[model samples]
Target: MSIRLGNSCVNCQKYEDHFCQLHETTVGTKHTCDSFDMRAAIKDDNNCTTCSRYMSATCPNPKKAAPHMLCNHWAPQEVA
Candidate 1:
């Protein structure tokens, strides 16, 4: 297998060496499988980093909310 990235083992949850831990078959980092489960480590879009209340005390929710956790407090981040 060659060192590769993108929608494949490098970004999948079951990636393990030259094979997928879920299917137990030899796979490459450039080839995605039907059972692909994206790794949680991949940065998500709906996050506190992009929220308008990211660093403000007015935000009612936790400061470090889950990557996809959003609430009524969500507002478009203001451009400086």
Candidate 2:
């Protein structure tokens, strides 16, 4: 499988090829079938290097009750 970095993930310099604590290591796939936090999506442009939602452990949008998938905030990296 191929793992694509989303726009958000790519924007953050702190995020590397090694993240995703649920898998206990960087996942190497388009998207993992594991449960991940949704809050990690809200990153502070001036303060945070990346959003905590990358793996916070809870869905911020509980009203939607979205499925447990890779960070929805993740935007597939653009190919030049």
**Each model's TM-score, in the order given?**
0.41, 0.25
- Which portions of model 2 miss their true places by more than 4 Å? 1-17, 46-80
lDDT of 1 by residue, 1-80 (tens): 64323677757888766778887788875678788888876544656667877668767777555556777666557421
Best by TM-score: 1
Worst 10 residues of 1 by lDDT: 71-80
Worst 10 residues of 2 by lDDT: 42-51
User: lDDT tens digits, residues 1-80, model 2?
Assistant: 76744544223333346465445555443444425433444332421113344334443543543333434453322231
For model 2, what is the C-alpha lDDT against the true structure? 0.39
Question: Which residue segments of model 1 deviate by more than 4 Å?
Answer: 1-5, 42-80
When superposed on Cα atoms, how far off is each prediction in RMSD? 11.0, 14.5
